[model samples]
Target chain A: MADLATFDVQSMNRVDLVTVSGRIDSSNAGQFDEILKGIVGKGRNNIVLEMNGVSYMSSAGLRALVSTLRTCKRNRGDLRLAAPSERVVDVLKLAGLNSMFSSYPDSVAAVGSF
Target chain B: MSQVEAVFPARFAEIARICALVQLEAAAAGFDEKEQFRLQLACDEACTNIIEHAYGGENRGNIRVLIRQRDGSFLIQLHDTGRPFDPSNFELESSRQPSADLAELQEGGWGLHFMHSIMDEVRFDFDMDQGNTLTMIKVHP
Candidate 1:
């Protein structure tokens, strides 16, 4: 799969902030899940996905987030969202998955929440 | 507007192209940015369902997509020569809603839910000649 989405991960003391930018669809959603799972595998379950740069996300992307969230919770950590665009938030709300993940206005607040 | 049709292999790689084409029609039909995103999301989920359920895998079949505009409605029809399936049944069979509870949320059922919620109308039909067809309509407001 091509890099329909790209991300840079910054490991904070209490959280790993991943700034993701691009379209997320069925084509690249598996890769997105793998990347997040890799971070969780490394014992960094507290994650904040900075998503203002994400222009689009489908159910496949949402599935990845759910799976990652479940894993994080099992490890006594969490996956949080930060600064998602209105479009992405609409999709999140449409799928009724918005409440599963906490949203922060900025990465600083997201990291502080952890 | 006249109906526009395109056929592509039932592969995950082709979903983006299929969605981009339909989005062009939706944009030309004067749908707003939010509506365009909704149309795109619905189309993406529909195609994903076809690939995963109807064809059962990628490269197993082809998907025929038809988009048309009439009155204030945008119509999207997806035809696949795979299996006879009903999307509503999938929704009915799944007892899970991801939003209902965080601890028990699962990932497999959101595609059909999004298609129904985002689109004004969603219907499924199966025919001997048509195989399986999923129709979705969005009204421009």
Candidate 2:
């Protein structure tokens, strides 16, 4: 409904780099999903989420991440999580969803993985 | 010692405002950073459900939050009057670890689980005239 989270998507060679900051919750997960759709549309599947700036994420955000992973993998792309803040990491850990995605210590390493 | 309360329109835009108050109350209650985040997430999921399900994302009606610390426990209650849906009657499909199969990855059932998991106790009360009140309790044990 509002700008809960904002992210910049860029193409770095063959990788799609997504730098996201702010909170991701139920209210704006659809808008977040739309942003991801645009990236996948451009044929860059290996997406890296630099989540150091994300202050919080709810189950809705978790769902968005999972579905996005599904979409990317369906297209032979993958979503790599990089440098998730402690809070974000805890949420993922609590949900048991952390291991579902490949996590990197930083964007440099995440982007390098693809 | 004293009660803290806030009421705002049941709008998604007001979530940040509500969450800020939750953070303030949790900190004042002497909750640690992890407990604060758990309280915040529990509150967020509760409020989000009210906005999306109760209000049908229309952003109408009002939601009231009540917070207080009593006997070494933090109590938070969210009240809303959109529709009377009892959480106890609903199944918590995603309460356990999500499935490894990609097709079983879910989205909608997570709010209840988060509320149930992070809080030490969770309960719901509602009536035709009183609306719904979600009570979440976390005791420092």
Fraction of native Cα contacts reproduced by each candidate: 0.76, 0.46
True contacts kept of 2: 0.46
lDDT of 2 at A95: 75
Highest lDDT model number = 1
Model 1, B1-141: lDDT tens per residue?
667998999999998888888878998999888888889888999999899999899999999999999998999999999988965686694334555767766677788888877888888889998699888898888
Q: List, residue by residue over B40-122, the lDDT tens digit for candidate 2.
A: 89998889888887778746788999988888988889998878775645554425566777767765677787888888888
Least lDDT summed over 10 consecutive residues: which range in candidate 2 chain A? A1-10
Checking candidate 2 for backbone clashes, the offending pairs are none
lDDT of 1: 0.86
Alpha-carbon RMSD to native, per candidate = 2.2, 2.1
